[model samples]
Target: MSNSDLLDKKLCEKLAQSASLTIGHDVLITDSFGYVVASNDPDRVDSLHEASLEVIQSARKIYHDAAAARKFAGTKPGITIPIIIDSIVIGTIGITGAPHEISQYALLIQQLAQIFLDFEKRQRSTTRTDYRKKNLLREIITYDSRSHDEAAICESAYEFGIDLNAARIAVKLEEIEGRHDDASEETRVHQAKIMECLLRHFDHPQDFVCPQNNTGYVVFAFGLRSIQPQQYLEMLQQKCLCVNSECLTVGIRLRIGIGFFSHSVETLRQSYENACFALKSIHAGIRNSTCLYIGDVVLEKIAASLPDGICSEISAQMFGRVMQAKNRKEVLLTIEHWFQQRFNFVQTAQALHIHKSTLVYRFRRIRETCGLDMYDLDKVLAIYLLDIRHKLCGQSDSRTSSIVM
Candidate 1:
């Protein structure tokens, strides 16, 4: 680390104050550039001290008596000690008094300065390490490995003790009800506590946790030997519920979404994307639920992977007339409930809280207006698939209307 970064002005002032109080003499602290950064005499601050420059160059302490002090500019009767860290002189500390009276305190002041400098150095090192870890996580989830050398990625993962071949799943956590934006400092503290709890609870050497785009937390957990995805997800769900229950008392709640298992680095990215999609699928109706899995919405997840234009085309062809009707939302809901109940008229009516005859009338209107054969198995499958696509992608009203050209 550079001298300016290691021994900043605020630290220099603190050292000067402590040294002055301990030795009962005025103290002056200078940077490597020979400028006084802190001093008991306020007028000396930011001024050049030529004698301290000579001490820095010689890498040794210089003592001058009252008679010898006249030879150097900005010099007083004192002992100037070089503040050395790791065999390099970073700054100088001078105690203004007779050489015989203040010379004993010179070593004590130098040791104190070295202590703080070492601490600052270590803090910078830790910050760099954290940045590298977060950067690696971001690249693993977003970078295209095909454009880079495969061996290099493997080597990088090895350095971090991450096994690329291990079975792992991505989990995402976010605040429900859109409460993240207005978070206060106290809320951020709770957020950090929640993240720390996750890291400790997982407690696997190969597992990783990091912030995702300042929005929420993401975790990548490597499964143990012979453990299946279902077992891992079940264990994680139980842990999340326990954590959520404890957090509720503190007025913070979280929703968790889990993706499918991935055994390779390439598929890990897809798993993370699936986790994000699952989290986004949560609506107001399911707000009470704390955990969601990608497997629960397989059809919607599959439709999300298809090209948007193709999904839109399929939706327009299958439900254009019904979506364009005066009561489009109601018609869509009825169709969704009918499919969800597996074409059982009584069950569908009960689910929707409507009379059986009313459901029959609605089905007849759908068949006439949309030109869909409800009883044909192939057409029924296509319509159900399109409905899932519409629910996931939220097809616009304008696109649902037939185009006139």
Candidate 2:
């Protein structure tokens, strides 16, 4: 029943006897605000309108004193007891014709108020618990599912009392060249320490943290200024080091996908895609422990547009031939000149400060090993694609390692 509806017929009848003691005397149940929520007598019920205002003014003082005293004094005469739920005073109840004997009944009324407040508090608490459970489940599904549904996301937000229009980000941790079990355990301990420390800096920082799977997910909702990605990344790296020096390696090795600031979860895929690309681009001789931001990769926009599968294929083909050459660096230097000269033998030799005959001998050897002549248009196209891949994706200093670039 609603709070107003809870004024039982039996309760009202019992209270009415005290209200009708003398003619013109009426029972008034003013809330903590002194407003008459219900009355036994119609004539005196009208007084509640003004009384309620007075009750509210008085309830604040009474509540304050009670807090200081650490006991419920109950609102005194000319005052009303407040019906509070979850630390909030909803309303007050007052008795207009209560006698000196009724003053003892003040405890009884306060006890009754406590019961109602406790019930409301429990109900609201349960509601909030259910809401968080549902939200967490929905986030899991959204993180895994490839498809995006605007309607479903919005509906979930409505049910959870989340503002769908607010900006949010998804963070994930992926382990590379490491065992999943150990990686999972380590990330849990590490992230817990990191979050605990960082939250102390923010006014209010709370996140929906998914467990430490091989790739764990964390969603944070906050203002843009609260998290500057670059600064946060640097700070996180330092914090991870404090957790353990090994954490620095783990942090560097882990692929972190940061979703764009978005209201719609669908667009988040773009961020994940970028992170994956950056992770896989790692070659052995490159900077081992570096944080790759999607924005930095985007700054070299044309680099990302290369045809899929072509770069790896070209690298593989060129690597095989480069390894067989008598002078690997010299061969690469020749190819570099060839590329610079637009594949013109005479021009390439001139650029390299070498004779045309010597360039021809080098080209002949390259043609023998690679099978396809570099002079041919189709082969030249493939070679060009390979060169582009090496410059954009592969590291130049990586040739000595297991990774050939």
Candidate 3:
């Protein structure tokens, strides 16, 4: 890259301000074209530091004493040093103070600024690579399956050194929402932080992540063949919990949906869809962070896929009286807790904070009103599916409660 390309204004501004703080003087940096690009003194920015141009031409330090400063246009009574990276002068840094007062810092400041420049160059290179990887991910995952070319996708994956042959787990993340406009600097900063945290946390060779448009990311992680799916999911669940904890420190509640492990690009797409379904399975009313496995959301996905007309017919046939019951909310809550506690009367009662007799009374009333055997597996399953449907659609009789089951 050219010397001007190395002059990142923000990086320059930050380094200038930091160095100024350390040395107790104003710092200024210029591009290769010898124009001031950043300065601790805002007024000096974009002003040509003619002395820096002299340092640039000589490729050596130039001291400007009071009389010398008067000769060069835009000169300050300090030292101007060329910032060299890889033996080439890319820019100039000028310390604004009397030459004798700050002369001791001339070499020290140039070395420090050059180090910062070298680090920034490496950082920018890494950022560009990450940007390419995310762009590739968005291309593969967001396109319609029919419209996407599998061959081209595989080729692009190979270019990025991604192994489509190895098994992988797809994860969808939703960390924040409605807090800032998607295009705002705040949103970008938060997204970058979360992505950086995830990349560090899942530092496996095969793990990759991409930020989604609005509020989240799509992550693909290497799948270990040594562990059972459930065991691996539990491990991933713990890792995601750690991520959530970190995000919470920043007031971000992270929600993640994990898909099952699978092989191949086609299966990868399916896994992505499963992750999406897992995300949808969550009740929007839940404000706390959560990480849900795809397998756990099968019933909810099935319920969600059902046509509205079918759901309506089933809802009417299954719980016509219960829907219109005077105590609809109570009955619904009771049913949900009973099923969640695995039909253990005492446990369910304890969960609901009601006496065992009172819990039985609710179940009895449910059976009578719904006109179905509450103990029957088919009847109970129907209720569960409809409950899931209601949750996914955000349809509720009262203010929606968190979907705990």
Instruction: Tell me the spans in candidate 3 whose CA falls farther than 4 Å from its real position.
Output: 9-80, 86-88, 93-105, 115-130, 151-161, 176-197, 210-215, 228-230, 245-252, 284-289, 341-347, 396-405
The true-versus-predicted C-alpha distance at residue 186 of model 3, in Å, is: 8.0
Show model 1 residue runs off by greater than 4 Å.
Answer: 2-4, 10-25, 30-93, 97-123, 177-191, 283-289, 307-318, 338-381, 394-405
Against the true structure, candidate 2 has what lDDT? 0.48
Best by lDDT: 3
Runs of candidate 2 with Cα error greater than 4 angstroms are 1-148, 157-164, 174-178, 182-191, 194-209, 212-215, 220-259, 282-289, 299-405
Residue 116 lDDT, candidate 1, scale 0-100: 88
Order the candidates by lDDT, highest first — what do you get?
Answer: 3, 1, 2
Question: TM-score for every candidate vs. truth?
Answer: 0.72, 0.37, 0.72
Error of 3 at 382 (Å): 2.1
lDDT of candidates 1 onward, in order: 0.74, 0.48, 0.78
Model 2 agreement with the true structure over 1-405: per-residue lDDT tens digits: 344443433444455454435323433464443445455655544243443454455444232222332332322233245555445555555543334434455556656655754665576666577467546545534554456566666566556455444554444444454455565666556655444433343223333333334333343433345777556655544432343334344452444434344454454434445544444443321123334444544423343476556555555655566544556556656665676576787898998898989878877877776554656655555544454455455555545322243
Q: How close is candidate 1 to the true structure, as a TM-score?
A: 0.72
Worst 10 residues of 2 by lDDT: 61-70
lDDT by residue for model 3 over 224-306, one digit each (tens)? 78988778788888888888789888877777888888787778878888987777766353212287788876767787777
In model 2, the Cα lDDT at residue 299 comes to: 25
